[model samples]
Target chain A: MQKTLKSLSNKDPQNIILIGNPNTGKTTLFNSLTGLNQKVGNFPGVTVDKKTGNFNYKETKINVVDLPGTYSLSPNSEDERIAKSYLEETNQNDIIVVVADATNLKRNLLLFTQIVDLGKQVILVLNMMDLLQKNTQEIDFKKLSKKLNCPIIPINARLDKGVEKLKEAVFSYQQKENIFLDSDSSSSSIDETMKRVGKINTIVDDCLTKDGEDKSYLFTKKIDNIVTHKIYGYLIFLGILFFIFQAIFSWASYPMDLIDSGFGFLCDFVSNILPKGILNDLIVNGILAGLGGIVIFVPQIAILFAFITILEDTGYMSRVSFLMDRILRQFGLNGKSIIPIISSTACAIPAIMGARTISNYKERLITIMVAPLISCSARIPVYTILIALIVSEEETYGIFNLQGLLVMGLYLLGFVAAILSAWVMKLIIKSKQKSTFTLEMPIYRTPRWKNVGFEILSKVKIFLFDAGKIIIAISIVLWVLSSYAPGNKFEDISKKYTSETSQQQYSEQEISTLIASERLEHSYAGIIGKIIEPTIKPLGFDWKIGISLVTSFAAREVFVGTMATLYSVGDADNTMSIREKMMAAKNHETGEKLYTTATTLSLLIFYVFAMQCMATLAVVYRETNSIKWPIIQVVYMGALAYFSSLLVYSIFS
Target chain B: MGKSLNMTLDRLKENESGIIKQINDEDLAIQLLSMGFVIGEKIKVERIAPLKDPILITSGSSYISIRNADAKNIEIIV
Candidate 1:
């Protein structure tokens, strides 16, 4: 950490702090200023994202730290608290660039004036100047600059207009002593804030002139009338959700397939080029396989985040919160929790991170805890292979495809489980913070595609690097466990398979597969599976299923791959071959056919409820800043999965 | 009779407009004041949610959503 600070200071980049109210395009301005040269880090002791970047002007590089958007220095949430503390700790030389919405100058200046009273070097950049002009409202920024004793630059951040001038202003910033309110004027903070607003209102009225009436938000209000309508509002939200789901599952699969094959080719190339040995096996099967699993989810995550960003950028997200607040509050979730819950269907890593919008600590915690309960895209493969064991793909009941209906039923079960769990958590968790749904409803506008692109890039980067590290580490460990045997057991199996009688009885490919399966049965993971068989037998899962469950902790979808390995199925993708093998198998004691309806349905229920994804748990730990929450999540969800599967097995049998 | 005369923002019907009187809750008042909800400002209830708890209100060019629990804290003049 000290080394990083030294490297950062070595550049001698002048500090330019960016602060603003929400929906003021402060982040858009930061992106324009820094371009692609930015890094997201955590604040000193808090989990709120600290976005820092640098831009070069002429010969000097200027460092910019984009603080979280806040209404005033008096914070309402952890995010705002970080912004306030960071501002209070700023060096005298650092220039505070307050980005204000040009259309709503009165509220925006509340923050600007607060910073000005702090007596720091400050620059006020009026963003959304185009909207101001379109509304026929004029801000005499030149006069306002003199009146407020700060540099005022009008720039449209979306269009990147006058940004250079804003930079030039920052480059030559001069500190001034301007206080919006006297220190001892009011007894309470509310009175002080009101006094400040009164002062700002007078200053704003003197420097602003309007022609006719402000109509910029009139169009938005009209759209809101329909979008927020009692019946039409819900229908529209559902329609959009349907479209997004289709794009994630259907459209994202094309790119996902390309990535899958690309990784497969890479693995093949590496394995072929390197000589066969333990090192080669570790590289090909351990590291590369783990990496391949992670990269495959990128397309789906990117698609989900892109749609979420667009929805948020166009200001539809706040309206969604307004519509969902009352209903979700009963579950101890805020309306902002809806985005994270919906995003959970694609992947919970991004969804857990998306819960940052919920300011209330309890609500955000519950949202994160229950998000993984929703069926994600990763569960699809497991559900498909398992469901196919009982019902064929073409089988249907009446008009609906039976297999498809089961998949839908599993998804609905997951949703119900998530909501119910959240309700339970709401009752148990204690919090003193007052829950409030005070959110700004920004006017609807075209999404800034550039910002959306940047958002996807950053979210994917966090998933790939932050969560990716843990996933890869866990994958290598699982590989070692399943690849190596306790002692000479692996050697003994290979030698037996190479004997003349065995070679004659089986073809070369069949012999190798038999050796592989036998070796796996004696391997550490397989032994662990055996040890847990008694515990899981009531749920209708045998030792082989136990092995898959052990491996599935790396990721739920690994159940399919592990099943193929244990069954000696050469092609893991050949679900038919594996299903046939599983169908023909028998219980060693009872001599009854395995893969019965009871076992299959029980396994399906298990996969739906298990907290088996390490990547998601790692993210939950980071987001909650506690190992305790993720531990509680695993314990509760595991118990739920166990009992639910047990109940299903009894009913089916 | 006196209780009926003391109007709160939450009691205002959809499309009804009210002038800011005082916010009983100190924290909510500070938050509202920063969001341009001054004591003398005119706030209009643009829409009430279908569930009728959180309502959308616009004061000047600033629009926001607040729950009825919070709206009950703000005294207003119809």
Candidate 2:
């Protein structure tokens, strides 16, 4: 015994670990106990982070490690490996928190008994107690504690109930006499164990009483009857998706306009107060305009996430997964792939990170590669502006606005492209393991508002922080590039314009327009745009459009701001909207219409598939732990975009 | 005739339960058990949700949900 113990100790350090099944509110409990005093670190050699939070119990500083949630410690997947190895290697865990769904106690206790055999301290937290009332089930806590030979605490984690009792119980925990395996008894064989288990069942039956039939299963069944109905399930799913898109487009309009107008008002106010200088121009035009371009889409992003969060929280997402399994399998994806695919609509970075949850490497890689093909919110502002410019708002099919339908079609095109790409990738990458899809359909519950709100706020904040920084920096650089030059052209225009009228005669718009055009024509950016003009000419884009495309590569929405700045610089009248100005643009040499249907379609196809954002690439690099993948991703996506646009242009022209 | 294994619903019907003889795939089985399908536990199939996917089972002092695909993998005693 001493030698065995020594060998185990030599293998790994002893530590206390928290273990639980997924969706058991384990993370919630961990958060409550640890609060914000937690740090995340990777395990010695693994990419998976080891989260440790300090908790004090009876003046003893306990290092609480929140292990990844797994169904069993049987290490089938990487997540399970970390959890199982940590428990097996660590002998010093003072206590183990076996969080179980209270509504599903029988399934939860399997792990409970396994932990008991480990001969360590154990506490069972029966989470989601509030769910029991709806199911009309009651638990005999004392009886459960006696049967398991551990303290049983009932908890409603979302509401913070039973947390104090849980903490107090942990502090006061005293190890009871250990249940030892009978040595020298060959009765520990599988057959003998089964007989022993039968005896334990008798013990359990005596200790616990249940009230009412299990309604959770019944409720889920009733809902699934319609939702999973052969034809109806598919239709309802489509209907739900349609409603979500409608809500995103319609509901977010008011808040988006408010934010847009608010920023415009602020810019005007700042211009009125500050003396005219480069600093003022930088703040009002460069910083404020660029930030406003990105910020206005927050409402649309928030609404999209809210619907998704509610669906996921209510456990309907799993059902959707189940429905899509057979279809997704054909594309070399499983039901789990639906999550990343759905999340990609918000931003490809988090969607790529979400692929981490997919247990299969091949599937995960495929998902990461193709996720960006889904049109994200970053693409929305660009698409919105372009659609408004190209597609008239006349009624189509009698009831549908042609513009709305065209926007919906663009979204559908991206979806189709993503599926087709995944299918092609599936044939390229080979896997031998028999892939299986297994998910626990959690009981449906009303989505907790706090959880939904927290999710939306965190996602929005991350988007604003990461994408906002890149946009601001790029905008300032672009401003400087388009503001100054090494030529008499800018100086000559300023001098001519200022001398042509008295200082009191010139309006702010007139003077600014003259300065803007003169500076832009001789600027470094303008020189580069002219150099790239030959390449973009085949696609029917002028030097100005080429400049906007180059900057928009940082983020798709930056295209609108780039165009706005470009047009604002050249337009002396300053009376028309950006859309009208774009419509009225003509080629300098031939006086031909620049934005013909052929060029518009070609540009639309280009934006549809291009790897446009550097931030997304950086995130992909970080998540995949290799620059190789992001580089490969950018090249493949760019080639696809170029060739696809070429094909579309040739056919149309 | 073999005696039935007294296990939770999640472990039943995929095959005959024989004292849960040995949970060969321990990690996967343990997860099923922790959801409340433990050894020496009595479970009954409550119902299955839409698409015949999520199976609802009753064990310990409560009800729980598990995917049907996962349920088929569980070896149980009848």
Candidate 3:
């Protein structure tokens, strides 16, 4: 027992926390230490990112947690509160590793001094020493260490220099007497801060030497001149956005096609090999089809995150925010909302999470509320098919496809709808909190490719796991609802179809197809679809389309699969696919053609304005920590979709 | 401390440096203070937005962008 207690006391993994001001290369340092061995979770009851990783240094295992970057311990934002709360939770085993940008030492030291004043065990890391060297600046590390009574290490985190020395410091650290800085004034916290700055300035003067002026700022300033120029700013920002959309669609198309067809082949193979039973049907239709819905979106999700992380890492997002603040503020959005709103085009789940950075509460709520209206990638399949049905392939002007242009116009309409909703919400929600525009503009630097790649992989993992779980569950439930019905309805359909197969001398494939379609039309899901048909009839939708709408509530892109199944049975000729079946659909009563330009346009508008995503609603609830907001979101978006679709259908039909 | 020495940060031109003397907005002052915008330190205007409302300033290598209204609350002396 005594030996076990001794081992437990001495061999427990040390909790080493990395804290620093933003843009100080702290994350880079954490990455180098832990590599891919990291656990990313949210802090308890909060959505703030908590990343912890394990690594073995010598004989000791250390749990290194990368705290969110903050300027001071006095928190002004949720991200900052997370950092402060975790730091205040300081156990005796906790050791703080504070990272400071060497090129900006005096300012970075302010946070370090505050941590030291709290008597925390800290090892100061001076990062960006390579940039310092380029500018011919030198620091007296030994003298500074003696004065601060802590080990000071200079390392270029990007290049992995001086990492070994940091490890040695962490292993050999011993508790020393806390030599507190002088309390020069009894006035206020402001005075205390002033005194700390005075101390940092003196230390900077004595231990630091600069031989030449830094020229990096000039380049940033020069770029800002054009990028933020009033007329040119908007144009350049639009150009960047155009290029981003182009890249997402073109570059990701190949992998997306591969994933789609791969899932199809797997489903077919499994169906053929497995015996005709409930399990076989469940595996092919329920599990594999549901999983395929998520896997196909992977390439698009990956490319979207890569673009965002690159923009963030290179310090260009802040510039875009700065340039957009004036326009966005008028529409009741914070400048930071642009990132989330634009990203929502790729997906709304992460877009809502991205709203955490907006400091103002009201602005954040507004951003989250309108974000999903931006028409995400799930709507792409719906739009592509609908647009093609309306506009023929020959209707292209030289290099531009008319159908592609229509899709672009739909994206723009989504943006317009989102902005308009934000405006209305601004008028409705009453709050006294004033919006503040105090953003930090980090110096421009080349993005770390490793970090960007890691970011994409991690975000993709979050989507694949979190949203993937909900989507798979919803689809499985949907499959069961569509497959079975009360009172032996499916059994009756199969028996009726079997007798017809024998009497008509139908082929084996034709018999199964007829049975499948007859069963689907009689299932509980089909009945629910018929029930909602009256509500959506004015929107120019039939019961078959109604079924697609019901199934796609789990995810918008399911409309395609739902339609494919509904149409496969409708097409007696057996040559037409989903798209062709949709094109050939005709009204039973009027004998007029369905899928007219007006009806297709109405469907597009409805999708653009509707909150038809279950994952987004759940995420919104999780993020806001309130059921009220998400309910309100659904009701409002649904009303918007209904009214807009009605108006379009009325005008065009 | 002279009355004539009181000049809000918004009045400071590009590349002009000042020492903060006081701040009119209490909340803004506390936030700016903790972020190295203390009364004694020097701050220099680095850049201005194209519309000229939000401007970037540097206080000891830490750059911050604040709107003109917020900047106007910070009283300084050139």
Count clashing residue pairs per candidate: 0, 20, 0
Error of 2 at A76 (Å): 3.1
DockQ value of candidate 2? 0.24
* Cα lDDT over the full model 2: 0.71
**Candidate 2 runs further than 4 Å off:** A1-19, A27-68, A82-96, A112-122, A133-136, A146-149, A170-206, A392-402, A487-489, A492-515, A564-596, A622-627, A651-653, B1-78
Candidate 2 docking quality: incorrect, acceptable, medium or high: acceptable
Q: Estimate every model's Cα lDDT from 0 to 1.
A: 0.82, 0.71, 0.80
Query: Residues A210-249, candidate 2, lDDT per residue (tens digit)?
Result: 6656666667667866776668888988888877776776
Question: Which pairs in model 1 have colliding backbones?
Answer: none
lDDT score, residue A585, model 1?
67
Q: On residues B17-74, what C-alpha lDDT tens digit does candidate 2 reach at each position?
A: 2333334454445444444455544556654444554555555444444555555555
Question: Each candidate's interface RMSD, rounded to one decimal?
Answer: 0.9, 5.0, 1.8
Which of candidates 1 and 2 is the stronger one according to lDDT?
1
Better of 1 and 2 by TM-score: 1
DockQ of 3: 0.63
Stretches off by above 4 angstroms in model 3 are: A1-11, A182-186, A381-398, A401-404, A494-513, A557-596, A622-625, B1-4, B13-17
lDDT of 3 by residue, A232-282 (tens): 988988887777666665677689779877877887788789887778766
lDDT of candidate 3 at residue A52, scale 0 to 100: 89
The lDDT leader among the candidates is 1
